[model samples]
Target: MHKILVTGGAGFIGSNLSEELLRRNYKVRCLDNFATGHFKNIESLLANPNFELIVGDIRNIEDCQKAVDGVDYVLHEAALGSVPRSIKDPIMSNSVNVGGFLNMLVASRDAKVKRFIYAASSSTYGDSKTLPKVEDVIGKPLSPYAITKYVNELYADVFSKTYGLECIGLRYFNVFGRRQDPNGAYAAVIPLFVKQFMNHESPVINGDGEYSRDFTYVDNVIQMNILAMTTSNSDALNTVYNTAYGERTTLNQLVHSLKEILAEFDPEIGNVDIKYGSNRAGDIPHSLASIDKAKNLLGYNPEYSLRKGLEEAIKWYWENI
Candidate 1:
């Protein structure tokens, strides 16, 4: 069985990936600083003999090296994630997302890991104005967060060429599901809206709610990472793939869906009012993804759509929150 090191393993996507790897009987090590990640996310996995946790920061090269040692694959998921937060503090975002990413790449290369699969972002597609964004076509970054993520791709490509280190970047769209944090100021829309409706508060819609996104589920992201790490196709290595469901949902549509779903749990949730606000800084109007590259090269087949994913997520939030 392959021993995989998952950076930010206590995070939403990393924890899910770690749990899945453990379920498949693979040895798993998690490296986390707990800046944004919570211990409760990976608490259940601690009891498993194959699961090991390293409480460390990716910004430190030694920590990255320690995590990469003896690991067959390195899944780098650590970063300060949020456009708003990045706008407020670009330096911190760059240090963690870019500097820390470079650290992990160097460590993984030294360790001779078979593959380095890191979480890239759709935000890299920034001002492109293209519908159903393709991997190769991108525009100038609109936010510091986008710039940092784009730098991850550039560095990964260079690492693969200069060091002959195998790397794959999963350019994820808006991913949401179980264990995703909803309390932070930078909480994702789905979880945040769900939380607001649960409290019977008016969920605010930014910019008349016309902005749309290809909201993906975390399970599909895990699938992409697994395929990227394990694929034998040489051409698939050192490339990026869109990790998304290939569908778009406007915020208005999204709010309506959430209300409908949550109403099943509490009938009065349908009556909760929705508020509108000015468009946020560093936010694009719409985002959609073309999953063709992933489908052709990685054999990617996403199992959940926005509605299906939201149903499951809402259930988890209802029971757990």
Candidate 2:
């Protein structure tokens, strides 16, 4: 039995991963400060005896060491995510994403954890005008958040080489699903759009709506994480893989799909208006991933396309909110 330590386990992506691990009967320990995570996400998991919650912040070295003490694998997902937020407060984002991440790495290494898998970000692709972003080719980081994520990959590589720590970084694209918060100013586009549509409020598109993204579903991300943690291939151990669905959808297409799906539950949603604003700073014009490396190395097979993922996500939102 593997004892896995999931940092930020109360947050959207972390909570989803933790739930799936528990379903598979793994002993899971969740370390969260709840800075952005909601208690409602993990409230049910607390009842399970296999679940252990450590109310701690990863920024503190002692807290990180405590969390990794007896863990077999460390899933480092604790970070302040959002380009705008990082732009607003680079110091704070650095403290959490970079400073805290370093603490976790040191702690995991010291604890002799078998494998360390951490969340990387697509923002690392930055100003590169590439059609399908690859793992090796990258551009200059555009924002503080992108810089921090790029730093994470660099640190992971150095740790693997210098300390012999087995590490894998999963460079996630725009991931969305249940438990993703839709209220905050920094909320993701998909869930945020769904929430606005549910309320019959107009969703604000940042540009002319042609800007595209490889909006990945969270389940696909979970599959990538699991594969990264358990793979027997030595070549796959100390590298980063792009965790995405390998397709692109424009913001206009995304909005249309959301309205169509939500309209099934409430017809009036289709009538809701969409408003366009100036292109946001630090936002790329488009993003797409080349998943060939993940497929060849980790045997990655994505189960949901954007349409299928949007349907399930809309259903969950309708039922929960």
lDDT of each: 0.95, 0.95
Model 1 Cα lDDT, one tens digit per residue, 1-321: 789999999999999999999998999999999999999999999999999999999999999999999999999999999999999999999999999999999999999998999999999999999897999899999999999999999999999999999999999999999999889899998889999999999999989999999999999999999999889999899999999999999999999999999999999999999999999998988999999999999999999999999999999999989
For residue 226, model 1's alpha carbon misses the true position, in angstroms, by: 0.8
Model 1 spans > 4 angstroms off: none
**Could you give candidate 2's per-residue lDDT for residues 150-247 as a string of tens digits?**
99999999999999999999999999998999888899999899999999999999989999999999999999999999999998889999999999
Badly placed stretches (over 4 Å) of model 2 are none
Q: After superposition, how far is residue 39 of candidate 2 from its true place, in Å?
A: 1.1
In order of listing, the candidates' clash counts read 0, 0
Write down the RMSD of candidate 2 (Cα, Å).
Answer: 0.6
> Residue pairs in steric clash, candidate 1?
none
